[model samples]
Target: MKAMEWYFPKSREELAELLKEEGALIHAGGTAIKEERIKSAKRVIDISSLPLNYVKKDGNIWHIGATATLNRVIDSLESDHFLVKALKCTATTPLRNRITMGGSVYLSPLWSNLMGPLLALEAEIEVLGRRQGTCKYEELLSDRGKFQGCAVTEVRFPDVKLIGWFDRFARTSTDYSALTVTIALSVEGESIRDAKVVVTGSKKVYDRLSGVEKALQGSRLEDVDVEGISRNVNVEFTDKPAGSGAYLAEVSKVLLCRGLNALGSAR
Candidate 1:
């Protein structure tokens, strides 16, 4: 086996220069680095020492630094905050302490519990290389290959008031999720002004249920047919150790309806 080369960059400029190296991979919390694909990389850049571990709110926007651990971010949010609800469903406490917000967004594995909520919130990520500006979370997911040289610096989203609910299905509490559902609704008076539905652990990694969102828009929360809307939506899944594709699809629909119902009850 070949020895791996490691780099510890002390500054953003230093990190950018190191990222220019061929096959260079960023290591924040080092949890995802255990993956076979990431383990094979010959060069690793650790960015934990940088001043990126922060969680703060400025006016109406919330900013979370890239190196901030999952627990750290949760500590800064209310118990009912969407991010707090979704992140609490991730790995065990020990692993959650080692999972960084930036790393989760960058890797976006099939079982990631972060991506679904981030997508539903329309979060934006700031990068430090190649694509140096801020880009919507969805854009980064769609064109990830184009930003290989970029290092995720921060994640920011508006502090919009919405009724949020998140749920994940797994055989065990510590097992990877077979399906994760996230729902956020903006309610005005007695109607839903807007809605965002996202599902993770699907064949496509994660997806936004635009059809369901459209159906919920401007509809009275009390009149929503959660079961019908959930059953009619199409979401493909791949067979995994957790469950068969068909089984997971069925589970996802059930969870979706449950999430919608939870949101409606919260209103």
Candidate 2:
């Protein structure tokens, strides 16, 4: 590995200016950066001092600062059960203490424990730099180039009244998941008025199961066959240590059914 220069930016403006240089990368928690080699980056711009660590609730939206560690998010957002579950699933207590939400959102690695839940909640990200603006989480992940000279400033999630559940398949609780599933639904009486299902490690980084959502929407919870509905959901996978693509697809389907069933059947 080559020696890399590091710079600490005290403000977003300074961070943006530093990013203007070629071969520059933003260092949030430094968790992911430590794991991989940024061959193209000669300088690392640290944004931790920019004061992005925070969690605030405003009416219907929850604002999470980019540098907020996973543990901080767990303690700060008390009402988001799914968020709590997902954060707890990530690494161990020590790692969670260092892993920042912005780093995870930007990395979106295969071992991600947060992406699935964030997608299910329909979270939006606020970035600073060339493409400085709020964009859907999926959109940002889809074209990471948009975040090229940028740093994630915050993540926003709606504080809606909905049933949500999250589950991940792994050899052990601490092991990275092969696949993760999250479900959020709005149930009116016994019928589902709206539904959202997100799965990670499915052929793509994130997949929204539209087929499953359409099938469950407007359906009476008790009458819906959760397992049968899950069969209609299709999830592909890339070749990874977890299992073969076929095996992962099957596991994703089973877990999706279980998560959706738990959310739908919840009283």
Could you tell me which 10 consecutive residues in candidate 1 have the lowest summed lDDT? 107-116
TM-score of every model?
0.92, 0.92
Q: What is the lDDT of residue 97 in candidate 1?
A: 91
| lDDT digits (tens) for residues 1-267 of candidate 1 | 998898888898998888777778788888876678576899988998899999999999999999999999899988888789778877778988989989888877745588888888899999987668889989888888978888899999999988888899898887888889889889999999999999888888787899999999999998899888987888999998888999889898998888888777766
lDDT, candidates in the order shown = 0.87, 0.83
Mark the regions of model 2 whose C-alpha exceeds 4 Å error after superposition: 1-4, 35-41
Where does candidate 2 clash, by residue pair? 203-236
Candidate 1 positional error at 27, Å: 2.3
lDDT of 2 by residue, 227-252 (tens): 78876877888877778888888898
lDDT of 1 at 169: 88
- What is the lDDT, from 0 to 100, of the residue 136 in candidate 2? 96
